[model samples]
Target: MPRLMILFTILLTVGAYLLSKALYLRYRHPLLNIVLLGAALVIATLLALNIPYQAYLPGRRIMTSLLGPATVGLAVPLYRQRSLVRRHAPAIVAGVGLGSLASMLVAGLIALMAGLPREVVLSVLPKSVTIPFAVEIARIHGGSPGLASAFVVATGTLGSVFGATLLTWAGIRHPVARGLALGTGAHGQGTAMAFMEGEREGSMAGLAMTLAGITTATLAPLMVRLLLRS
Candidate 1:
């Protein structure tokens, strides 16, 4: 694409995020979540201008390339909280493993109950995982990667918006538990929210996100088989 289009797309994406983040900071509301708000603004702007999504591809790829470094940065907080993690290792393992499995089973079962197609059920099975893993798992199971991406985003957005309140209502006061729940259910968005809560929570959330991804990847095929048999 043209240099001008690339620049415009980059500015639009980053500008929307900064603006939404500012609004979120000022209002302190879950509904004003930066990711959700920023995405809405971008989509609305593109649609209003009649800009094809293809025009945004270059900038999207550039931004996506940065995700690796961004994820690696989580290690800083994880390192700082190493002692606590070691102390709580058993709980962390069990919580993340169970949480990941539960998310897949619940999503798949609900889709099956709704009489959704087999492909739709498979796509939903990895909704709680981060997009890369979710897409691959969906592809492996002959599901639509595009649909899987949508499910992952929806799951993460909703989880980031309401997860903390629900945890509090359930009397889950421990930071580790909260972080694990958020990470396993929401992935990246949840990790962002966990960081906003505190460093300790953020570190555990980072760990949980990684562990949950691994656990989901390993167990998803079996889960699909079980759901199919049901």
Candidate 2:
């Protein structure tokens, strides 16, 4: 039974991925992001069938574990852009740090004002960061890691869907500015969109996303501690 369940899960995941990819290519809308589409389908199917998240988690984990290797693979782009990065080191660091801090501060303040529980606020405070680091921050701050994952996904989706349009509306035309904004605000999803623009933009966006994740991960716990104390 376990083997059959595993096989079924694998088949469903692959089918979903293929179908989502085709849809994305045809429609090419940010709001219908492939990741979001695939996740919605999986979650809806599981819910309809009354499958507990734990029951399906092992199969999902097998697929998710590959993300680490995939992230490490982004180092190739960084290496390729070493010279440009060196030239813009200070600007990159400052931009990413400021953007990450601003995102967390806004989320925390809104959550607090909305009377969300401290743990829920903490979970959302790091939502703009990358998934793995955000999960760690959530655990440290007494937030639910699963909820943090969902929050991160939500943040990324919103950022990817609206970020470019917002920037254009604000008259921001520089590739560096666009990449930095998307990478810092949306993390990987935004970076993916930035990459689609061009290699230079993609490299900068990747760098920004990594730095933003690190900054947010480092700051979230401290901010939560201070907020709780006060």
Candidate 3:
């Protein structure tokens, strides 16, 4: 029964994602993001069918296992853009490092000011990174990994939806700058959005995503110590 339930959920989720992707391509609208649309479709289906969320857990885990390979696949674009990356190495490093730090500091400070619990603040600190990195950081800091994952998804969704508009408003027009901002602020979903713009933008976003993950991992511990002390 559990096996059947898992298969059912996997099919449902994948089917919804395909449909959402098609719709997004047809409309070319940010609000129709595959992640956001797919998730809503899945949740609505489960609720309408009176299925317990527990029934979805096994499938979720199975699907999540693919993330590692997906991350590795990002290297393809990075390789294609290696010359550009080498040319702009110093600026890229500076941008990604500062962006990563700013995200953590801003999130932590806001959470602290709101008087959110320690664990929650910790989770929020890594919200801008990809899920795997965010989850590990949350765990190391005694934060709820589940909450950290949620925050990461929310950040990515919002970033994917409005990041370009925000960047344009801020007068950030360079491909590299825009890509770095999207990847640093939103992670996977942002990278997907970046790919829609151009290959150069997508490659830069992929690089930024990887570097930002490393930067976040390196800085999070010290940031946690400081946040705790404050």
Candidate 4:
């Protein structure tokens, strides 16, 4: 029964992923985000069946492991955009650094004002970055990796849902600007959306995502300590 359940979970996850991708390409709906939709479907199904998350975590971890390779694969798009990246390196670096810092600072301030636990604030401080790096940063700052994972997922979802709209409103229309905004604010999911536009956009977005992760990882702990001290 356990083996069957694991098999079923894997099959269901794949099916949902494909279905959600199809829907996104067909309808162009923000709500049809493949990752978000697939995650929702799997979580709902598991909860309805009374399957404890822990019971399925091992199988889920198998799928999650693929995320690392998938992230590395982003180098393809980035390599393709090398010339453009070189031309705009300074702008991209500045934009991503500012955006990532702003995100962490805002989230940290809100968390502190709300009187949330210090660990929770630390966890959320790096939520705008990728999960693995965010987890490491969170742990170093005496935060919970589990909480960081949850917050990073939430940050990605919110960034994907609203990122494009916000950029348009801010008059950020160039592909480079759009990609930078998405990657800096949304991370992987946003980078995925940027790639859907073109390789150039995707490459820039990947660069932005990488820079944002590195910057946030280093600065978040310092900001947290400074904030707590003051």
Give the whole-model CA lDDT for all candidates, comma-separated: 0.85, 0.82, 0.88, 0.83
Q: List model 3 lDDT by residue over 133-158, tens digit each.
A: 88888989889988898899889989
Error of 2 at 139 (Å): 3.3
Candidate 4 on 8-41: residue-level lDDT in tens?
Answer: 8888899889988888889976556666677788
Q: What is candidate 2's lDDT per residue for 1-230, written digit by digit as tens?
A: 87677777777788888888899889877766676687778778878888777778678778778876876776686687788778888879888889988888888888898999877987998888788778878988899887898898899898888888999899988888888888888988888888888876777888888778778888876788766665
In order of appearance, the predictions have TM-scores of 0.78, 0.87, 0.84, 0.78
Error of 2 at 186 (Å): 1.4
Candidate 4: residue pairs that collide: none
- Model 3, C-alpha of 193: deviation from truth (Å): 4.8
Q: Candidate 2 local accuracy as lDDT?
A: 0.82
Cand. 1 TM to true fold: 0.78
Against the true structure, candidate 4 has what lDDT?
A: 0.83
lDDT of 1 by residue, 1-230 (tens): 47888898889999998999899789876667666678889999999999999888888888888666765575675677778779999999899999998899888888999999988988999999887778778999878977898888788888888888899999998998998888888998898889899987787888888778778989987997888965
Candidate whose lDDT is highest: 3
RMSD of each: 3.3, 2.3, 2.6, 3.2
Instruction: Give candidate 3's root-mean-square deviation (CA, Å).
Output: 2.6
Q: How many backbone clashes does candidate 2 have?
A: 0
TM-score of 2: 0.87
